[model samples]
Target chain A: MSSFSTAKPLKKKFTERLKKDFKNHWQMYLLALPVIAYFFIFNYAPMFGIVMAFEKFQIKKGIFGSRFVGFENFHRFFISPFFWRLLRNTLLISIYGLLFSFPLPIIFALCLNEVRNRKFKKVVQTVSYLPYFISVVVVVSILFDFGKANGLITNIATFFGWDGGAVISSAKWFRTLYIGSNLWQHLGYNSIIFISALAAVDPTLYEAARIDGANRWQQTLHVTLPGIASTIIVLLILRLGQIMGVGYEKIILMYGPSTYETGDVIASYVYRTGILDADYSYSTAVNLFNSLVNMVVLFTANFISRKVNETSIW
Target chain B: MMKRSAGEKVFAVFNTIFLLLLCVVFFLPVWHVAMGSISDPLKVAASSGLYLKPLGKPTLGGYRLIMQNSTILRAYGNTLIYVVSSTLFGLVLTILAAYVMSTRGLLFGKTFALFVVFTMIFNGGLVPTFLVVNKLGLIDTRWALIIPGAVSAYNIIIMRTSFSEIPGEMLDAARIDGADEFKILTSIILPVSKAIIAVIVLFYAVQHWNAWFNAAIYLQKSRNLYPLQLTLREIVLQATENSIIADADGQDVMIFRPLIKYATIMISIIPMMIVYPFVQKYFVTGVMIGSVKG
Candidate 1:
């Protein structure tokens, strides 16, 4: 009874302080209202709808009134023939993308750094970012026009012994087209960060290396690489975190039934089933699974990066 | 200047040549499309290589035909409306969020910031988001394009970083003269934030200008509301030439179909090409600002 009497005054004091704070900064709270409401309606509300994943969803019944089905939706996905194919396609496309699209930018930046003519370098850099600004729909359109049976890219491929009828619709060529287009689109834009990082490297380090009789090649290896190493590592860690997030927009634009074998990924599959086919419960369950896996991968990458290099996004 | 060895001289020549060739490769596709758009349509359809020049007498026939298509014109107008409205809407919300987040000693500021940043890492995926939008009756409306994606947390964070860099003394000086939070934000913060604001505006404008997926899914029944990029998709990807060239009779349709695709692409991209060069430096500045916190 004595403890309860003491707790009442403490609780009252806390509320009094909170009320005082609110009075002092009521304008700030007012400024935050729309932003908070926007997130609540768009982001948080959808998160709440993730509950539909466990339900046998019906459009008429809606999310709350839907019957509970436990893990049956998940079971259906796992047992489906598409499960393994989707997983493989997603990993392969991401891994291939990482392998080519990652290092090429760094190399391009390094090469640009060596150019003596500032005007030439500026022009090249400007032109390089142009493709990045092009829409995916147009980029895919370019692919279609250039990858047709008698088109420019196809003719070039035939000279190199490609027996495929058309590059765009071929399952074997889907990953290549996707990753290559990404490289074309992003190589210059992605290198912007590295270019800035290179600029920040101390000029005195290069002077010292030259004073020590180091050649340009030797200087780059000894001085420049070490300067940008942290930026590289941080970007690599960020990249690893998004390894499962090959977006569906470009894939949907590029792929057809013919290329789904090599092109169908988790997000694209979710989009097809959920939006196109209206398989709400099953699609949501599959997507929930994908999200969980992505979160796990991101956390694991961040943890390992922190332990190893003392650098993490958080 | 340092004396160059033979190998160094060779490398210099090779590097310059390589970068020049790379520039050519980068510019070729757009050049190809532009050249193809004006080329004789019959000659283009029969050809099978990269277009070095417009073949068989260059003409503006493609442009004339495309201009006659009401769908393309209406779509262009729709895209402009979306870009301007969304950019203005997004910028105001971003400034508000950035101001609140950058405020020092505000209670729950960190909590509010974390709430925004958490959205960047995890989202509820497509179905739930679609369901929410559907439930709101935004399925076939203009609000579907503008409202749901109006505020990006990434933009908020970038703008917040830029805001936090402003001298707190200026804000404090305004407060001492009986200025409220809104007064300080408008009179002090925003005027000094023109560069970052330009960057954010460009980001939002370009995003809305190029967007089609939302329209593709949301505006299924409302073809009249379709943006330029979505119409471009139907013409280029689905090869639905009939939708755009509905007025053209038989022979004219066959001749102008391929040309119309090229012209539409050129039309959609011209605004970006013209505007980007002027704003390019601002984009670089934005990237630099984003990297400062990242």
Candidate 2:
């Protein structure tokens, strides 16, 4: 049997690999069957519907039977005044998030890690997490009060002699309010993972750094930061992948027609013109564009991560 | 090797004060909501600043007003039903699926694992999902809320990973004792998997609790079945419209707005926050379980 199979390289390799997979791990296959079937049915199979982006999709004709329209759907969206604005807003918000909001949590976790008072640390951690559980609707409602012209935030701004009226509604302040609230909502939640990663660092590394006469700052820079470096890179890469995928519901809840120029993003636009207006074909086209950009960003990020740090999702 | 210096002590104290202040700011809205719910409605509407204390002699009026609305009560009922049913259904199916996927002896485990993970990375976006849900004839029904979102992809992955951490010897012994896969899963696999199960339940419950968008989109006509979030959202819409109307001063001040808004915020969040501290240890661990490796 070996001699016969060795004469045919492709067949030999296929059968050999297949035999190894089955003989020793047949129980694993049984365990994996339903989940495998689920992803196929639910996730991968839906990729076929991306074709509807090129089609004049109709419920009666279905995704396959619908007539293809070339790039008409994309053309409709790109020429519309909202396209450039949405793209600009999405990238700008994501960039702001990457620059400011992302680091606060890391710094917070580091600070929390350094606190010697365990009881005080626990209390701080508990309070930090409370804001994360508050619903987006509730968060926006509070932002409304803060951003209003006569709101307490406005009142505070007035005390400082800075204009704070209608911060949420104005084109100028929408990004700040959005990103600021985002930081508040996620800072505690985001720090938890970093803290866990911090826990995994070998205490010996800290000891070794200490023997070098390192101060807390020096030790953090030389040891603690480097120890959790991979976790940070992986997280940063994941965040980069989501540049186009900002949380849409919050935007939808907060922004109406008056605020769309500054606050409207890819997801909200899709939700509005696509889902709300029942413009499935055009919406699907726009969404397909979003998915494509997300894929590119994710792959580029993964590639950079693999090259720089040798850590990647793949 | 030196200890934290006096300069560092001052910085630490400042940092502590800053974080505490931020925490207070973070929690003020929640506090306002709780206070507004119990405070005199007129007093709450008229007041400004942080609302640090109960404004006056507490009244049951706001709760009374919210409760008097039968739709709110019905929506609450639907939400509770959805939360309980979905958590139970999701937990059972997830455990079964996780057990199946975690078997080292299973022939197709990695392929299946890859399949589950693929869904997490890439999705059909919303259109195809909506189409599938619609095709299932679940539109505008209570079942739309429960059945369509029965299994969370992330939760399933976590459960599968959790189940894999269980020892191989236990399962081998169960099989040798003539206990079938189903029996082994229930009696042996599940007993050791309590923490993961609790975490997934928390996740699914939160998802169900905050699920206004699905109910908003699906049950557009059925006000009777609208969840509290959607009802609260409708108030947001109404609040916008109401602000357009003039008061006796001929000024649109968004009157009586902050009261129920704060009250709704309290209603939606306070329950979850109260429940959180209890399951917090497991929750902290589970949240990392979702993000770190994910």
Candidate 3:
């Protein structure tokens, strides 16, 4: 239709729209220039370099010039004895973290919500959130100090006639110490979201429950929990998505040779092999495997949550 | 609002006890560390149990030792520089990106937003990121810490959300008066966006302070450039093994280990602790906006 009669007019209209659009928003583009370039170089560039996992990385040869080893690095990672140990430890630690460390904040928030005393509630919330800001190094050091044979917590245990000797270094105690400290650190801070959701609950629902002669527990069960259910499910799905990606800094700080049985995670392993030991290609392959699994699990969780509960981050 | 029943009163009593215990559990460690850092080194070593108060008269020996240590001093300076420079640089990038994206008529906001969000879930792992930094010749340089994490995509999205909440009429009024994008941002947007700015700066500063892994990797050969956390970690690692060995018989090692370790921990965290209460309110709101809005 535009071949002869309307082609000229349509072309004119398109160019005019393009010119007007650019004229109006050139300043926005100018502002976005540095951000685009920064992301391009820092984020996208490293993404392209993920290929080094399949290649022999050499300093002199750089990424492209290096010889492609085709699955050799991945092969070594898969066949190595450390592979299964690493995988087992990573999975166990993640699962332990998911099991024990996940429900804490919700419970804390729910409990805090039930408190009738305003001043006491504020104090509890403020005091509880303080630990969240302490650095991982300091957090672990506190653990180490308290877990020493004659340290505070150990002494407390001894006072109660229980053995707490060298708990930090014991393999069996590693998961407990790690998850417990994690619970101590993040429980209050993470509860802020649920607390905010609680604060947003409709007042009419509570009044309605009260008019129906519902007790506090019944009201909480009927009105409060359902009010924040979507928030709970969304947060749960988000947490589940990253079950494989525990923060490695605290683990690295806390774990020792003796406790590696329970403590070594994928990130720390990657740090050891890739950065410390300089096995770049092999570690890259290992990390890529972890990341791919995380990506798949994350999307699967999101999909299932969306389909079942109609709640998701997206 | 109604009168409390017996069952409700029982539940409230139990809840109060539980929350009080929870509060003490969270607060006791920090209190103990703070108290122990100032306690006599010999007393700390010999006590072998909790001290509700300083034992054998508090001494400044531990802090004095940390202050005199050149490594700790240098790391302190390095951390300060990293925190300030990184916060400023990151804020600029974040604000610029967020403002542009929040603009009503940006050509491809959705495409750009997707580009940023995709990096959140998928990325090059450790080796590839290290390789990129190595290729850029940022290894062993201060720029390594400042450049790699300069603009957080999540923070940008949060700031964008904040900026978009600024009414369109405000921006349009400025534009009609012949202000350019930069002028409009400085005069109209910046003046009203203080809350988000303060929150982002605090967040970035805390992140820079807490970060050591990046510095450990990028500044592998440069001990002098190591941040405070990295230096503190080294001390803790060495002291851990030494203390375990010393627990067998060596009194001298035991005397100094906890003192030095606790002193270092307190020194590292003191800044954040000092500023936390003043900025505490913003943190809750900031986190809520980021999480709920996202």
What class would a CAPRI assessor give candidate 3's docking?
medium
Considering DockQ, where higher is better, how would the candidates rank from best to worst?
Answer: 1, 3, 2
Instruction: Encode model 1's per-residue lDDT on B1-294: one tens digit a residue.
Output: 789889888998999998888888888988999999999999988887788899889988888888878889999999998989888989999999999999987777889999998888888889999999999999999989988888999899899999999999998998989999999999999999998999999989988998999898889799999999999999999999885688666566678676899899999998888888788788888887787775
Model 2 over residues A1-314: C-alpha lDDT tens digits?
46865678967777887898776555545654655554555566566677778989998999878998999999999998888999999999889978988788899989888887889888888888888777777788777776677666667767887773556677777788899888888888889988998889999998887787777788889889998898888888888888888867888888877788889999898888767888888887888889789889989999988998899976
Clashing pairs in 3: none
- Candidate 1 TM-score versus the reference: 0.97
Which pairs of residues collide in candidate 1?
none
By lDDT, the better pick of 2 and 3 is: 3
DockQ of 2: 0.45
Between prediction 1 and prediction 3, the one with superior DockQ is 1
Best by TM-score: 1
lDDT of model 3 at position A41:
85
> What is the C-alpha local distance difference test score of candidate 1?
0.90
Report how far off residue A44 is in candidate 2 (Å). Answer: 4.3
lDDT of 1 by residue, A181-276 (tens): 889988988999999999999999999999999999998899999999889988888898778888989999999999999999998999999999
**Model 2: C-alpha RMSD to truth?**
4.2
Candidate order by decreasing TM-score? 1, 3, 2
CA error at residue A42 for candidate 3, angstroms: 1.7
lDDT of each: 0.90, 0.77, 0.84
Q: In terms of docking quality, how is candidate 1 classified?
A: medium
